[model samples]
Target: MDSLLSVCDIKEDVSYIIDLAIKIKAGEIEDMPLEGKTLAMIFQKSSTRTRVSFDVGMYQLGGRAIFLSSNDLQMGRGEPISDTAKVLSRFVDGIMIRAIEHEDVVELAKYSNVPVISGLTNLEHPCQALADMLTIKEHFGSFKGKKICFVGDGNNVCNSLLLIAPLLGMDMSVACPEGYEPDENILKISKNFAKDNNTEITISSDINIALDNVDIVYTDVWVSMGDEAEKAKRLKDLKPYQVNKELMDIANDDAIFMHCLPAVRGQEVSADVIDGPQSVIYDEAENRLHAQKAILYHYLK
Candidate 1:
């Protein structure tokens, strides 16, 4: 069985998959082939977008999405992830997991007979990145040579962007605090992919330098979910990197603002910017449905 654990897992085929999603969004298709299939969704992390989109996407495709909360499952009460995977594989056509550790997803895939998808992990958010890419394509028409700048915490979202952007020929710049830089191994791997694809990927501590002439300005919260204890400290250190009007001015006139929500209004992005005309946060959020439909179609078939 195949799985979508990272952006790298989809690789160069993302554009094709996203095109299918666009077709779905435009109402060009009626019956999706996975009519009788079942998607078992296991989410350890509480979410709005990921949970809703996958459940809705499966419904749209004529499939059933069974929501399995962490507390509702034996896996939450000390059962091994592999054992859970093995059991779920017997009942579901596919499994989607949103968890804290990336390894848990890997372990599930190891023992499962059915396909396993990574809904969200601490290390990468491949599905969200796919949606973001679809939105970018919708607005810009093409990703080739477009500079996308991401400012703030170099977390999972940033990590996926760094890895996936190169595959589509998009130049990417990430600006973050000194010690909060993206995973070095992931960075190195993406850089190598960038080199081969003729796309430049740069990471810097200087926010202004990264935003210069960038076509897209992306950001996430100073503190992600489950990082509540670090919130105060992160807000202090990351305030300088916030994407407000001042930071947006450094980018090109057409640069669009993007955030993977639940955005902290005054923290990672200003309210005026996120709620303003240029913001594509809602559009990004909506595309989650479309993009996952594409992913489900690809893997299920």
Candidate 2:
């Protein structure tokens, strides 16, 4: 638990860490283990939940969080990530990094003496997936045997979900356009984990089959932060997969809709679906704070 590089990095003992989160959320735990500690947050891209949640979550635990934009640090001026990681490690107890290049975060972890958390990267969004699982557990009371389907581009979010969902004994499926499937390595690793856990994980391009009997219907923007050039074609290709009433109708009657927000109204998901009674996007977003507080407590302790 020294650093959170990926969901696969969490060993079996991690269940106790999640239990700590549940206790902290219920106010059963009073004193903060990270009291007087400081977290150095490095961001190469702009954010909403990741920024605010980490800052506030740290403060609530009697710790300080310092936000450093690429422009605010010497690294903005072409400094090597290794040098930056070495320098920052001396000053902070932990480093949380959100960047496009996954390698930079790896370099940070390699050089830093303290923990390095991956806030987000083009290849994975582990913390987001963690919060998402937390939200799912809150709604369903258990992840075991629950079917969760993700529709749209199998991007970083999907990649991480594909990795972790099965590890918790949940069935996961992804529906994406041809050739847009999740990372091969992540999928391969997840398949192995699923085999060991006796869980099922599948992927397909057919949205209907993906949604059938799913307990959770999830989606993300057709075009992500770095895919502006494909926006038009994506809008057209993804139109059929939109989580509208019709698509949702194919899922379990009580199936909940989830989106890691900053959702495009008519792109990845429809406005009606996100605002619908089944939508828990806001709850998913809010849990970012609680789940991450749990992660911080686990590593810091």
lDDT of each: 0.91, 0.87
Local distance difference test, candidate 2: 0.87
> Which 10-residue window of candidate 1 scores lowest in summed lDDT?
25-34
Could you report the Cα RMSD, in angstroms, for every candidate shown?
0.9, 1.2
Put down candidate 1 lDDT per residue, 101-128, tens digits, no spaces. Answer: 9999999998999989999999999999
Query: Using alpha carbons, what is the TM-score of model 2?
Result: 0.97
For every model in order, what is the number of clashing pairs?
A: 0, 0
Q: Which lDDT tens digits does candidate 2 get at residues 1-301?
A: 2688788777464456556667788888777778989999999989999999999999999899999999999998998888998898889889999998988888889888889999999999988988888889889998876999999889899988988788788889998888789999989998998898899889999887788779999998887788899878888887788888888899999999999888988767778989999999998998889888988887765
For each candidate, give its TM-score against the true structure: 0.98, 0.97
The CA lDDT at 105 in model 1 is 94
